[model samples]
Target: MRRPHRVAVLLVDPVVGFDAAIAPTLFGAAEADGEPLYEVVTCSATGGQVASTNGFALVPQAGPEALDDADTVIVPGTRNAAVRRDGRLDDAVGAAVARIPATARTVSICTGAFVLAAAGLLDGRRATTHWRHADALRALHPAVDVDENVLFVDGGDILTSAGLAAGIDLCLHIIRRDHGGQVANAVARFCVVPPWREGSQAQFIEAPLPHDDSASTAATREWACAHLQEPLTIEQLAAHAGMSTRTFIRRFREETGQPPGVWMRSRRLDRARELLEARTLSIDEVARRSGLGSGANLRHHLRRGLGMSPTSYRKAFADREFTDA
Candidate 1:
């Protein structure tokens, strides 16, 4: 049997306690075939107790040496003076980050980007951090491209997310990347969270409902998901939500972080991908079910959205029954 993926989370001193908990909660909850898919280990610079916000301390299971064999390393947010005040990694932290193998993926949650930036891992690469620290990150490391709007930035092997709850979205995304939609969805279901929130979603949305029960486009969005195979137009959706077309467009964007048409296209593509992975459907059938009109149209969208053809995508992610032996 293939060994489970090893994940090492490095907790720096003066850590954001909430940020420190995300990785172990999310990745540790991901499972396949009734067993954990990732072996998550928390570590600190000295392999001992680390100070955190709120006057709490975390005792890690291991030390920086854990990075040496990890398949992925996560650096949670910290207010460590080295990275925050001086814009440099402390000697121990820098040395530990350097021990991460080149083949291993790196992730930073919130202000953890400061550590990565200080260590030069983000040079010339697009990254993000807490919006409050965006200006400072840019000023300190002028070489790193920082976008403060999105929930997360997936820079191939190096991923960075904005503050707090954005870490959940990033972790879910990584699960989807590693295990495909079905497994990721199962994990999300178990965790009682939404299965997919695109990385492009805004870090903040202005409109707020007093309660989830308040009148909103949520029900309409749910309806839309069920009918993705059918042709869905903004006007039709607007009418279903009992709002004017103009109002619908504005409200949908505010609620979902994407325009109506863009969100529909994304849902369709997502359905296409799930079908490709989980079913024996032909490309034509997948396209038809996903409301892409035809296999040709499906190929166009898949190529543009995922940068791969249907067959190739299936080969990479499909179950054995879906892909030829």
Candidate 2:
């Protein structure tokens, strides 16, 4: 059988303590048919007690050598003022980064993009960091395309995320990309997090914290997910959320970063993908169930969104019958 993918977490000095733990926890939780899919290893540039921010020290089992065989290398954010201010990685960290094989995928959480950009890995690539640090990252490396809005940017092999929780989003995204939607959804259920948040979703939403007295669109969104097969209109959703169409539209945009119609369409498309992979439903039936109208309509959306035909997608993704195992 296939060997588990090897992932190395490179703990640079004065790392963001919380950021250091995200990948290990997320990747460690991934499994398929009771077998783990990734072997995650934590390493440091110095191979010993690496001091992290918030008064914590991480004792890695190995050093830079761990990256030699790693199929993926993750650089968690650090609080080193020099790296952020001067746009330079420490000599040891730079050397360790250099050791990562060219074939290996690289990822960064929050300010970890600084290290990657400093090593010239992010040049001409779209990347992101914590929104607070986006300006600094751009100032330091003008060649790097920094977007401060999205949850994460998947640059094929080089990926970067916005901040702490977004790191979880990035890891979950990687799982979803590696193993189809069913496995990722299972892992998300195990972790008690949302199953899907597209990369284009905004990083921050106004009024994220709901007040008890305020009407929330959260319940409506969940309700909509259950009824995607129906023709869900903005007016209907607004009524469900106890607001006028204009008011609901404003609140929905504030809360989800996308207008009501866009968000719902994206959600329906996601459901279409899941059904395409996990079910034996025909194209017409899948289209009807996903509320994309008919086979022709589904074909249009799938081609525009995924650049592939339904038959082709099903052939590629319908490998194993998906069960919530």
Candidate 3:
């Protein structure tokens, strides 16, 4: 049997406890054929108890040595002064990070991007942290493109997530990429988390709700999801919600953290992916069923969003029949 993928999570001093736990929780829940898919280990610079931002300490399972054998290395959010303020990793942290295998994929959660940036790993790469600290990250590491709006940035080899919950999204995305949507969705079900959230979805901060408790766009959203194969116009959606176009748009954004058009496109793409994974439909049929209009349109969106064609995606996931218990 193939060995499980090794994931080493490096917890720096004063780490955000919540961020540090996300990888273990999400990755640990991923499995195939009743076997754990990832071997997750928590490590620290000295293999000692590390301080947490949550008024506690975390005792890691290993030291920097664990990184050498890891298939992936994850840096959780930290408040290490030098890394955050000066964009420079201290001696121990630098040495610890240097032990990561050259081919190992690197990821960050919340302000953990600062540690990666300080180590020069995120140079010339687009990354994100918590929105509140985005300006600080940009100021400290001018070479890294900091996008605060999105939930995460997937730079192929290196991925960075926004705040606390966005880490879950990134982890699930990695699982989906490595295995298939089926495995990822099963893991999501086991973890009781949303199966998918587009990485480009906005990081909702202080989003407002309508003044009236009854004024929600939720039912309309469900109706729209059920009718994705049809051309869903904003006017039609507004009419269904019993609101004007402008009001519907505003409420939709407030509730979903995205505009109607953007959300609709994402949902359509998701549907297309699902059809490609689960069915033996023609490309044009998949596109038509998913509301993408045509095979050409579907190919364009798939290439832009996933860098693959429908046939390629279908082939990649076609034989994956693993289900979670």
Question: What is the C-alpha lDDT profile of model 1 across 1-325, one tens digit per residue?
Answer: 5677899999999899999999998888887667788899999988889999867899999999999999999999999997998899888888888899999999999999999999999999999998889999999999999998888999889999998889888999898888788877887887788888888887764457535533578889989999999998999999999889998888787877789899899889988988998759999999999998899999999999889999998888755323322
lDDT of 1 at 151: 88
lDDT of 2 at 164: 85
Ranking by TM-score: 2, 1, 3
Model number with the top lDDT: 3
* Deviation in Å, model 1, residue 229 alpha carbon: 1.4
Candidate 1, residue 25: how far the Cα is off, in Å? 1.5
Worst 10 residues of 1 by lDDT: 316-325
Q: Output the lDDT of residue 78, model 1.
A: 96
Q: In candidate 2, residue 270 scores what lDDT?
A: 85
**Each model's lDDT:** 0.88, 0.88, 0.91
Query: What is candidate 1's TM-score against the reference?
Result: 0.93
Quote the positional error of residue 81 for candidate 1 in Å. 1.8
TM-score of 2: 0.94
lDDT of 3 by residue, 106-169 (tens): 9999999999999899999999999999999999999999999999999989999999999999
- When 1 and 2 are scored with TM-score, the better candidate is 2
285 Cα displacement, candidate 3 (Å): 3.7
On TM-score, the leading prediction is 2
TM-score of 3: 0.91
Between prediction 2 and prediction 3, the one with superior lDDT is 3
